[model samples]
Target: MGRVKVLGACPLDCPDACSWVVTVEDGKATGLRGNKDHPVTRGALCVKVNRYLEQVGSPDRLRYPLRRVGPKGSGRFERISWDEALDEIATRLTGIVAGFGAEAIWPFHGTGSLGYLQGLEGYPGRRMFNVLGASHHAATICSVAGGTGLRYTLGTSGGMDPEDFARSKLILLWGTNPLTSGHHLWKFVQDSGAYLVSIDPVRTKTSERCDEHIAPLPGTDAALALGLLHVIVSLGAQDERFIAEHTEGWPEFRDRITEFTPERTAAITGVPQEQIVALGERIARTRPTAIRASQGMQRHAGGGMALRVLACLPGVTGDWAIPGGGLHYSTSGHFRLDDAALVRDDLLPHPVRTLSMTRLGEALLETDDPPVKALFVIGANPVGSNPDQRRAIEGLSRDDLFTVVLEHFATDTVDYADIVLPATMQPEHLDVIAGYGHLYLVWNEPAVEPPGECLSTTETFRRLSHRLGLTEPALYDSDEELARQLLKGHDLDRLRADGFLKIQPGSVPADKLQFVSTRAELAGHDPLPDYTPPADKGDGLVLISAASHYFLNTSFGSNPELRRRAGDSTITLHPDDAAARDITDGAAVLVSNARGAFEAVAEVSDRVRPGVAATTKGRWAKFTDGATVNATIAERDSDYGGGAVFHDNRVEVRPR
Candidate 1:
């Protein structure tokens, strides 16, 4: 009879797992706002999420299951019943398994939802896929490279808590623009009243606000880090006691950095020698200095090495023993969830090959053992998110591939699907989320009923399990059961009563810091910190496909207001680079490389370095000219994990 409020959490692939409150009236969500009680959220939501109601109520919401009626990529479909769609999907999957084997079926997913029950790590379809002996999906498009790199030096990605940033004396924002992506972390950095330094090739919005901005040539972060460490050691500022007590292989790491003098580092990184010396001095003297190293910096060929070297900074300075000191690449390591229970990989028939999601094109087209015949897409849009857009689209266009997509809207990936199933959004689903930014476990209660025929991902997989004649009990577990299983040891009662709960008590332990890692050596890499320049360094301008302020990796690419605010698909260029090619501000230009090319409007500015060009990612093909910015990106792997090299490519930008 009246409006009521319900507690939930933002389920997007963001660091801030913001606890939010939804106002409901007549079983429909009327309004949503950030939870003021949450420390990181602080009663604020990002600009992109402020208009989320429109996204849920958009006219384009896919309300019913549909079957493709036209050729692939035609976006033509006819409405179909759930039974019909599931029966057809089951029939096709059975045929593919009979002919090519279960390895031919790829259940591709991504970070669209970070919910433990429905999102990337949750594995909503993992049980059925494991029971059928399906190939594993290596979700490496995001933080894997950095996480692996951090592991080399620290043994874990867990580092200084973001809440402890308020205790820091200095903070380094390395290749991250919190104003655009991790805004919640910014509040702590500001609260510390610490000297802020932004280290990035692009003079981002956050960089402009920093106390100092140090622009280095992209892909040379390891050299810069070593150079800084060299200066620290020369100044005799390294914590000898910390090195002797907590770290291993310090002698080798120290010797390795001896060659990375300020002059030598400047030559490689394009940062001025004087600035490097000054910043190095500052870092050496500053106590409890924290570095917020995000995923953006580790998206290159040598991404893992870069993070490894950077992580050594705190260990050298003995900052790891302080409240605010350490490197934070990710905080997911702190949450000890029951992963075995969540995915149930033990049910797999036998060992199956794992395919890299970063190299989706190769998995679908060039895979020889059993070529991918069926693709089940959930919580991701590859055409807009994956690198090598040309190859991914080509593979998706294959007529023989049986594709089924579960989505809220008809995305670029949906066009290539043989069957499109409408899936419930966050407000219509129950999930438990852990923030990679903060140390909180959030509970998301379903606020509204699913619109039209939309079903939750867990429900969809359960139906598929039944339709496939599978009798696995775990596969058919209810949402409540799955949640209870995932939250076995955690204080679920407090979390439900308060909407959130801190999973851990304090900052990372001092013993967690290690200067050198034998694990890296065992992996055939140098055990000590070092720099390796990217192999793709040619005489062309470097391309930086950075994140957008208004979109979360293609999740909000369809919002009209957000799109308008994002403006045209534009490439930002240095004034010198623009003048060299006779390109003017707001002029249409073409960015091309050996991989592929796309058109964009030019914005001549000094935001980027002379030899670098920048563009925001998440432009859908239909949003622009049938090609997204990813067309120019290669599907190359980083050194540690098979992470995509999104920022390691060289491209040519010219007037169209």
Candidate 2:
């Protein structure tokens, strides 16, 4: 019996790029643990990832290629050879291009594995799709709105390093609950000894631990930010020197901020005037304050504007010049991947229309010119995660639509596929991983051979490209070649030895905190940092479908242990709202809107505001009734970045 430890990195769709050690005994994985040497990992894995071995070793994992034998969404398939699967996929895609043009083919990708080679951002099928002139997929489900807004103000989303948060005297957890979703960064927050404050609509686990929890109305973040700025300027806390030297359009912005006084902000945000005043005063007095604005906060109709307004707070206080004082949305901009070399967009024969993934149902159902005939789903389950679930499912049910999915499990999206290819998991594949939460890139080494005939996404695409008989040299590049191309000008040996590479943040004067007056013009917004109210105000409680602690966007949704720990799909409402609806805790309820409906167990609590209903996302349709919270969300786009408005939804809750 022999035991060995292999170094690898996590490739899940998380901000923390965790470095881990896999314990293998007799050629089988015995255990897995975090690398204590890595500052972000700190020798611990989150609750979701702690039980990842279950996911890797699950009996339900797809080990062989499948061809659907029953109707769509039947979850019935017959085992097939890789040659059969790849041949069928290539033939169907070629037929689709010949009959309906290449624009009919959509390569739908997602952030299942945030690796440079296998994930959505890596452009998994870029060379083939571009060479074939297929329609472009706009990846805007997650942080695009917030990142776009931050870029307009700060010229980049990269800001204060997570390690520098320990130097802060005040830390504002703005719409981000790092303890549940991103537990690694909490170590630095704990070490900071900072007066922590949580600004969210619901009292999350992180909020309960914070020194202050200010529950504002949903979709009213911009109002709260403007109100804070109003108080800062009123108290003469504004840094005149920084504003003069570093900012733009302050006079106009100040004039706009004046409109949002404490009383007005309290009315708009549903936060008490006194609480707003006190928090504003605290912000004015606190030096080296850090604001961590997450992706969830910018998932509303005015989400982009909300981020733009929140980003101005640091400039108003001159926190940009100090350590642990800037607004941190993401550190992804620092990692410069050779995207042109990898994506090969130059191979395109002509310009192709870009379709938004957020409005996937529309793209699938309502698109007219060259209706979508072929869908190549890569590492994404849109039927379970995308908005307007009914339309997505209905569109997928089309008998004429030829669909192919690359997945590890029989996900909701896989149920509707014509060909389902089994893909390798993190431990069974090689990838170059980067994180948005911190500044580091980890080389994910394959710890074990893939089970059965499973293949990595890169290998799958390479094989499919060959089966198509296309002479695209870039499409046939090896995984190692792709990794080296992405890690250009970096030490490969050092990266392999250390298991990670630190990406130094870019050094540019324009990268500093600076507001742009032209930002409002880009999205037809206000002249200055202004509040754009939610489009829908007509009815019942505002629904917020946030990230779950047990699941990472349907990645581990099939794990029995994780599912048991997560319990049934639940919707948490304030006691007052529950009483008004004549609903009791633990009762089955129906949450419905104009878009659709779903079933959930009601949890009556004071954790959420009266007019707000809260629930965690990423539950499978089979786990719940026939839909998840996504069913109730409309196909609406944010004011900026064409992002999904998941939080801008309104729904009614009643006894089932």
Candidate 3:
């Protein structure tokens, strides 16, 4: 009867990388809880990660290698040894490279883990393919659009820490549901005792808890920001001193915003003219104000431009000089780490062709020249998460396309695999995890032996590279060695022992102002933030596929307790919209658009405004009654950064 507690971190693709402690008794993990020592996590995990032991010890976890025994898209397989699986994969890939060149082998991956080493696109796993001269993947499935847009406006993405929200006098939560995703940040916002205002198309769970909630039309946030700017400048609230001393091209920006008066913006954003004016005045007058945005805003046609315009609020109001007073889109770029040392792009065999991850369906189905011959996937569920699920799945079902997936569960993507390799859960790997929402970098350590014959992604690829006979000394670095090398800017010893470290923010030139112009300025498009309408427009209703409180992207979509709480997938619409469409509550309704469509039970609610149907992401095809929600989404790229325009989707809903 022996019990021991081991420290670890939740390495999911979350902004708050929570530190945790695992209780192992009799050589088995018995309990898990958040580490009280972690300032950001504050001894509490989200609803999803709280039941992670079930995920780690789930009966359905893949414990062995598998080979297809039935038709594609069917969950049928026969167990195979690691050696046999590796040999077959190596031989097939070898034949592929020899016949069609290394570029033919397209390696697809996503943020299955956020660990510095093990998670985030299966780091070292891609090293093998890179040295093999495989096709280059533009991993912009998420965040890139918003992150890039904000960076262009702010000079750098560095901003106030989430914990610093307590110092603010007013907080604007725009396009973010902090209660579900950024819980720690929400706590600070609450503690600040400031006026909490939420501006989102949906009256989200977080909006429900806010002092005020303002619903704007999807893809129209730029108009909202511009409207605010018009009020701020007209009412003499613009920070004249800061603008004269630190900023560039303020005259053009000011004149340009006058066109976005409350009435004009109201027509665009669907918010009342009076509400827009009131909100704008409140923000301008509020000292030590902060605007915390989400990556979701960038998942639209005009997403990049929206963030760029929104970032200007702080500069106009002089919030950048004050702690916890600037716009906090992400504190990710503030942290320093040796990323080149970790991924080692210098090891690439040669320059390679590029493919867009946002348009996976097109890349898989329409890619030419040497077209993608063989597919190797790791740490991603593209079938469920990627837009145009039907096309993505159709490509996966191709008899010619040899597909492989490395995962811990038999996900929808795994069902179509020619080979399925077992992967270790978070507690079975090593990582130095960073957070976009916090200041601490957490050390993730294994708490128990992995179930079945699972292998870490790095080790699996390292073994495959050996089998393929590519002997670069750099390719064979141990996980510990890799971890130590990537941790140059931070204290390795302190992080290893204490399980967490508070990272200091990066320094930018004060004279440059927080906002740095990217290029030549003309009508807010060049050096200044611009407003661009979405290219796609539907006739009937608007559809937004966003993350539910239960799932973060596609990570923990299968846990029993979590999934039970999440209940079954359904489309939520305002009661008014449902009534107008003659859609009854709990009745099946068909939601469709030009790209594709899906059917879900109606849950009439005001979680989202009228004409907007809201549902969750990460539900696999098997979990859904019909097609996955992503099927209704287009495989479109954003205005900047090649990000997926998930929120830009438009659809019509009616009784099925």
Give the C-alpha miss distance for residue 134 in model 3, angstroms: 0.9
User: How do these models rank on lDDT, best leading?
Assistant: 1, 2, 3
State each candidate's clash count: 0, 0, 0
Task: Mark the 10 consecutive residues where model 2 has the least summed lDDT.
Answer: 507-516
lDDT of 2 by residue, 1-656 (tens): 59988888888888898999898888788899998888799789888888888888899999999999999999899999999998899889889889999999999998888888888768787888898999999999998888877777877777778888999999999999898888888889999999999999999999999999999998999999999888999999999998898888787788888999999999999999999999999999999899988889999988988988888998889988888787888888777778788888899999999988888889888997899999989989999989999999999999999999999999999999999999998888888888888998887888888899999999888888899998978889898888888778888778888898788887422544546557657657665667889987879999999889999998888888889989988999999999999999999999999889999899999999889999999889977768999998888899878998899989999998
Q: Can you give the TM-score per candidate against the true fold? A: 0.99, 0.98, 0.97
Q: Pick the candidate with the highest lDDT.
A: 1
Candidate 1 lDDT by residue in tens digits, 519-548: 888989877777878868776799999999
Predictions: Cα RMSD each: 1.1, 1.3, 1.9
Model 2 lDDT on a 0 to 1 scale: 0.88
In what order do the candidates fall by TM-score, top score first? Answer: 1, 2, 3
- Model 1 is weakest, by summed lDDT over 10 consecutive residues, at 505-514
How close to the true structure is residue 585 of candidate 1, measured as C-alpha lDDT? 99
Q: Which pairs of residues clash in candidate 3, taking residues 3 or more apart in a chain or in different chains? A: none
